[model samples]
Target: MTERIVVVGAALLDGGRLLAARRSAPPELAGRWELPGGKVEKGEAPEAALVRELREELGVEAETVERVPGEWPLRSPYILQVWTARLRPGSPAARPLQDHDALRWLTPDDIWDVDWLDQDVPAVRETLTRFPTETR
Candidate 1:
């Protein structure tokens, strides 16, 4: 059996808004919305991996505020976990310069409107709950 790969997703919150990225590739996942993150490299700590992935994928320095609390199954041999994050002090706002084609900063009331990846919905919902009601 193939070893399962742990992929971390970031629910990057700035103020009361949550950042959602629109995927652009890997035919199956194309055009869907997701929390931005990448696979954890061998021997890399998950938090460190998450920060690195945010920099690579979003072009900003992020710090993990907390883990969002659960894991979800992706394709076979992959699992998705999410974290709460914020841009590091002095870091610019994130841009969609990588695997994503677009970006949206969703307020709490409208966060549900995006077409999120099915496997990520639960974690996304949990991430949404992390925000204050005024934002959500």
Candidate 2:
């Protein structure tokens, strides 16, 4: 079988909150919420791809803080990996200028408030575990 494509998702953190974006494309996924990220270029590293994706999708520069510790499979030919990320020192705050129509910073107790895309549930669940106990 052919190797699957890798897609990276960012659990962008600011203080004790995680970022979430609302999709606006590809009919089926429209209206669903997900971590903001995109496909990894063939020769690129997943962390690099995540930084690139956050910039492209949110109009902000970010740095990968750490990997979220597990992988989730998408439909054939694609697998999703998540990483913790934070905005760069002088970068602007994230703005939804592409693919996504909206953005929100979610507290640990509010993690279940968004209607996350089905394929992203596993990664989201894993991310919640990384939040500090005081925040939950």
Tell me the tens digit of each residue's lDDT in model 1 across 1-136.
8998999999999889989999999888889999999999999988999999999888899899999988999988999989999999999778888889999999887888999999889998898779977754
TM-score of model 1 vs. true structure: 0.95
Separately for all candidates shown, the number of backbone clashes (residues 3 or more apart, or on different chains) is 3, 0
Cα lDDT of model 2 by residue, 1-136, tens digit: 9899999999998889999999999889999999999999989999999999998999999999889988999988999999999888899988998899999999988888999999899999999888878898
In candidate 1 the C-alpha lDDT for residue 6 amounts to 96
Q: What is the C-alpha RMSD of each candidate to the true structure, in Å?
A: 1.2, 0.9
What lDDT score belongs to each candidate, Candidate 1 first? 0.91, 0.93
Give candidate 2 regions above 4 Å deviation. Answer: none
C-alpha positional error of residue 105 in candidate 1 after TM-score superposition, expressed in Å: 0.5
The alpha-carbon root-mean-square deviation between model 2 and the true structure, to one decimal in Å, is 0.9
Model 1 global lDDT (CA atoms, 0 to 1): 0.91
The local lDDT score (0 to 100) that residue 65 gets in candidate 2 is: 86
